[model samples]
Target: MAISKPAVPPRIPCQQCPLRPRPSFRDFTEDELDFVASFKVAETPAEPGMAIMVEGERNPSLYTVLSGWGFRYKILEDGRRQILNYVLPGDMIGLQGNVMKEMQHSVEALTRMTLCTFERERFPQLFRSQPTLAFDITWIAAREESMLDEHLLSVGRRSAYERAAYLLAFLDARAQAAVASHTELRQLPLTQQHVADTLGLSLVHTNKTLRKLMDQGLVRWLDRGCEIIDAAGLYRAAEWRPPKEGARPFI
Candidate 1:
């Protein structure tokens, strides 16, 4: 319902996709590149807080985030929402809806976002002709599942301090990978409410835990987001380390 039909932004051809050139991503072959260019139908923008996809809806289009951030979530009848995971540029969305009959969860933009839309009907053709790109799509889904696995660990077993530390450290590492420049560090673009929702903690508890980290010089809470001041310290506090990922595939 939140999808808007404003004038399209100047589309970036798949051959010149900025995210493709990032070291974190693997380069596509010429054939794969050409297929992607055709697969993409248009470029669209979603404003902050817009609902990109809703539960139980069948979406005809898929999207790859061109810029900015979003989060996947599910809501209950009583209005309780659970934040599933945050999405970054180059991440594919609407796949769950495309593959299944309807969306099981919802997606909402956390910041102004640019997204490359793909025709859903052509998705099967890629799998039939381009096995490698099909594998890339599978890999992307697996990676998302892996993130959910870790979140499960945090919420099910980790303590409040450990949860806060692990969440920030994990997000910082993910942001670094998604960004084009490794040297240009940025904030997590998250508020305490987002943190609490994601971690399954109360807002007051989330604030208290964040304050504790700030006191230890592990992280800083800005007005709109969070900054990891000492990633190593946070890792130590959380007793966790990020995985050493090689160049990952994206679609």
Candidate 2:
């Protein structure tokens, strides 16, 4: 938690939040919005590479990402890290921390990020007063689990080409939805090591596989990241078909 910056008033209030009008996000009722506005404790910032939460730490607050990107990972005793999932706008983190004695994974920001913080103790109030919102939160957890299931399958069963293609396509699709209304498509901010850790592949293997993708024009590597050049092509190569989804809930 490197948010040593001074506290400041929230620039974007819940009512005028930029993400609300985007087609990717489910709409909130006036009452629900009001409650959410009150639910927020503060808006906090996390710089790139900052640890938002660490494994085995007890976090006092939960977070809803308001902007930018982050990833969840778990490190083994020997220092090897396995990325669990990518976090984007509207994703709620620290829920597990609230439920368990300590967090099982660590989260690190990939870009300068803003997060809406909520008191962990206030979670019970939401469940008691807002059944609908509680269900929405449950749905988010279920969806994350489903995504992890697919990743487990990929790591265990898929080929190198298939894994690389699927990973890029998946990130592209999710980024498109998460960054709604942005004029340009959001380029993924991922390094080869990031993909390797996520896919359970060696760094060299990840490089060769991504090179194959670049050769075929499916993706292009940038300074410390890569951009999805042809999403449909990558999807076809991976033989992955993600289920279509409409606007989904975000707290």
For candidate 2, write residues 89-120 as lDDT tens digits.
Answer: 98988889867899999999999999999998
Candidate 1 lDDT tens digits, 94-209? 88876689999999999999999998899889999999999888888888899999999999999988898888888887888888455645589999999999999999999998
TM-score of candidate 2 on Cα atoms, chains taken together: 0.94
Indicate the residue-level lDDT of 196 in model 1: 93
What TM-score does each of the candidates earn?
A: 0.94, 0.94
For model 1, the superposed segments whose C-alpha errors exceed 4 Å read 1-6, 180-184
